[model samples]
Target: MAKNNRTLLLIIFLLGIFIGALDTGIVSPARTVIASQLSISSSSSVWIVTIYTLAYAVSMPIAGKFSDRYGKKKVFTLSIALFGIGSLLCGVSNYAGSFSFLLAARVIQALGGGGIMPVATAYIGESFPIEKRGSALGLVGAIYGVSTTLGPTVGSALLNLVGNSNWGVLFLINVPICIGVIITALIVKDEGIVKEPKKMDVLGSIIVTLLILALMYALTNLQFHDFKNSIASTKVWPYLLAFIILLPIFIIVERKSLDPILNLKYFTNREIALTLLISFITGAGMMGIVFVPQFGENALKLKTGSGGYLVTLMAIFSGISAPLGGRLVDKYSPKLVLSMGFASTLIGSSTLAFIVAKNPSFISLLIGLAFIGLGMGFCMGTPLNYLMQTNVDPSETASAQSTLSLIRSIGVAISPNILIGFISEAGKNISPKLMTILPKVTIPGSNTAVSMTQGGSSSISPDQLAALQNADVTTITDVLKQFSGSMIDKFSPMLKQQLQNSKLPKGVTADTLVAQWKSDYLAQIDAIRSSIENMFQSTLNEGFAKLFIGAAAIALLGLIFTLLLSRKTKPVSSN
Candidate 1:
């Protein structure tokens, strides 16, 4: 390939990754609007993301096998076309206001989107010489990292610029880009690396797909709030049982198949197996990156959207470190580079778990984030892909990359439930604490300080008070804020009625007493609101601290896997 052709190919690959990853998060900001317009419950609307993840994970190995067996260029082109068609359908679903249509369209979109990364990666691994491979693959990894991290921010910017009515533009905008990529992909000459072909392992593919789908389905449905019950429920256990039953069946099928979709040898090779394990741990650690915004809101009490800016800051470091990490891999052994990466993550997550989480501050958070960004840049991309590419045969390069991605996706999929379970369990006392506050709150504006529990004397009715006590931790702050306002509104009318029935003293007018009462009442309500907010914030802080602690544990596990890698770098094979 000419230099210009490689550059164009790289550009096309980057664009594919960007659009696909961008869509992964782009729907999040608009989820509520989508739900309202489609008349779906907020909880049900999560399926849009859930279904895409499941499809994306399932398609990875199949796509990789297709690229390896057929050709990268052809599969790349087909994948882009599928993605484009899916985007079109998604846009149409928005117009039609059909949630089911949108979900089906998302599955098509994910099938294409999932294929792009590994296939593009196989191209880079095969196309580039060993010396340049790290840099090229690292750059690809950086784009993927940055794109996924920035997805929500970009979505928000688009939503703000175009407004909610134009939400479909998010999906529609991909059509032109996909068409352009497909055209370029068609024009690019396939490298035509040949190997003796065998029959496609259709059964192996089916079993693996079913196996992954069942496992992911179970993980996605695990309700963090009701963890114990949810695990025992039909939503989780049935799929889990399916996965367990299918695992041995998949192994048996792959073992007998001459040309398996996933080469069983990769698992048998100790180095590759360790590398895959490390990749899984790395994916779990990367979950910290995803939750950074929520962590900011919970721990630091940052404004709603401002947390994304912190992610942008981390992305800048991640983007820089990716190429730098790749360069380091080219210089030193991968073991050394990987060890350094995991250590950085361990330090970063520990800082968050212990120091910043305990005493939330901007400066402390920045220190922790910087280390995490550096760690993610190092571990997530170049090292893992480089190992997979080098370990497997050229014919299996795409399959190898896909297998790596599939395992990592499982880690990414599972970590949230585990981390969130910790947070949820820690904050279970939030409602009880809130109930204590409600009963004890005394309104000072009354002739005698009145208890909030005194229904007839209080502006807040008993039913409304009970509702506040039952509020979920996620929405308690907003619920309390609204409750405060409604209480004040109710107080004004109630006080006005009281004044008409009361006898006034000589110097004081009923109007003056009413005004004073309103003033005092507002002050009291504001104080009460502040106290409730503080309690909620405190609970969140405790929850997030545990979340970060769990993340740190994952990083530590990655470090252990890093230690399990071959101490010496193997010379690149010239196959």
Candidate 2:
């Protein structure tokens, strides 16, 4: 193929991957709009994103294996067509006001999208000269980072511009892009077929599908807020158990198959196994970015939509680092580049855990995020792909890349369940801790003081006390404010009763004492409110601090794994 033709093909492939990744997260901001328009519950509407992810993950290995068996060009164009059609159906489903149909359409969209990243990555691995491969794959990482980062923001912008009723436009917009890519793809010269294409691994494919489906279904059902209880629930455990049972069966079946969906032999190589282990850790670390906005909301007290801008900051850094990391990979070795990436990740995650989480300063947050973004750009993109591509047989490039993607996704899937548990556990402690710190109110012109904790003569009403006792991190601030107001209300009548029953202090008139009492009460209430707010905020800071620590641990593991990789990779021959 001519160099110009290859460049065009790379552009076309990048576009395909860009749109695919965009749709993965773009639907997030518009889920409520979609649910309200379709008359579904918010929880039910989540299935729109869930189903798509489920289908996308499940289809990955199959798509990569298919690309390997068929030709990358043929599979790539067809995948685009499927995605375009799926997008069209998704738009129409919105118009028709059928939630079920919309979910079905999303499944189709994901199936197509599942093929894109791995296959395009495989194509680049095969077609690009080894020297240029890192740069190209780095661009892939950069594009993916930018798209996923922008997905929610772009979705929100689109919804605001088009109005909520025109939400279908999000899906419909993919049609033209898909068409352009497909047309360009078809025009590109055909990459020659494999000389002897292995027979389809039908049995292995079925088992792999069942295994992933079982696993993802269980993972998706887990409620991060109630991690322990949720994991124990029927919604999570049974499917998880099924996944465990099916995993060995799938591996056993794959081992016996003449052409396995995932070639088991690859695991025998220590380098490949280590690369994948590092990739899994990298994926877990990547989830820290996903929760950055949530971290902002809890620790920094940032408004909801503002978190996207914080994520955008990280994405920008990742984008810059990706191409830079690629060039470095070309200049030195993937091992060196990967080590640098993991080291940056360790620094970033540790900063977030110890500094940003405690201080909740935007500048510190930015510093933490920048390092993580650099780490992600290095670890997630070219170096890993380059490593995998070089280690694998050329014929199995797509399959190998797909396996890498699938494993990383599983890590992404699992990290939230564990990391969010740290936050949730902290939240559970707020109510008990708040009870011990509940303020005591003192009446003016009298020595009498009433603890909010006591049942009799307390300022807090029964309902307000209950609210305080049950308050979690999210509701604690509002509950405190409401209770503070209630305390004042209840105290006004109590003060009047006390003043009526008891004589004023010597030379102090009733009017004078009343005024003094009012002044003293307000001061006390202000101090109490400030104290309670600080405690609640501190507890939340602890929760988020733990979340970052968990991420740091993953990044640290990634850094450690990079040490095990050989200093120099054995370069794969272009010919």
The candidate scoring highest on lDDT is 2
Once fitted onto the true fold, the runs of candidate 2 whose alpha carbons sit more than 4 angstroms away are: 192-195, 222-231, 432-479, 483-532, 571-575
Candidate lDDT scores, in order, read: 0.80, 0.81
Candidate 1 residues 225-278, lDDT tens each?
677899998989999999999999999998899888887778778888898899
Off by over 4 Å in 1: 298-300, 431-519, 527-534, 571-575
Highest TM-score against the true fold, candidate: 1
Q: Write the per-residue lDDT of candidate 2 for residues 384-451, one digit (tens) a residue.
A: 88999988878878888899998888888888777877767876677667767765567665567766
Instruction: In angstroms, give how far residue 193 of model 1 lies from its true place.
Output: 2.4
Cα RMSD for candidate 2? 4.6
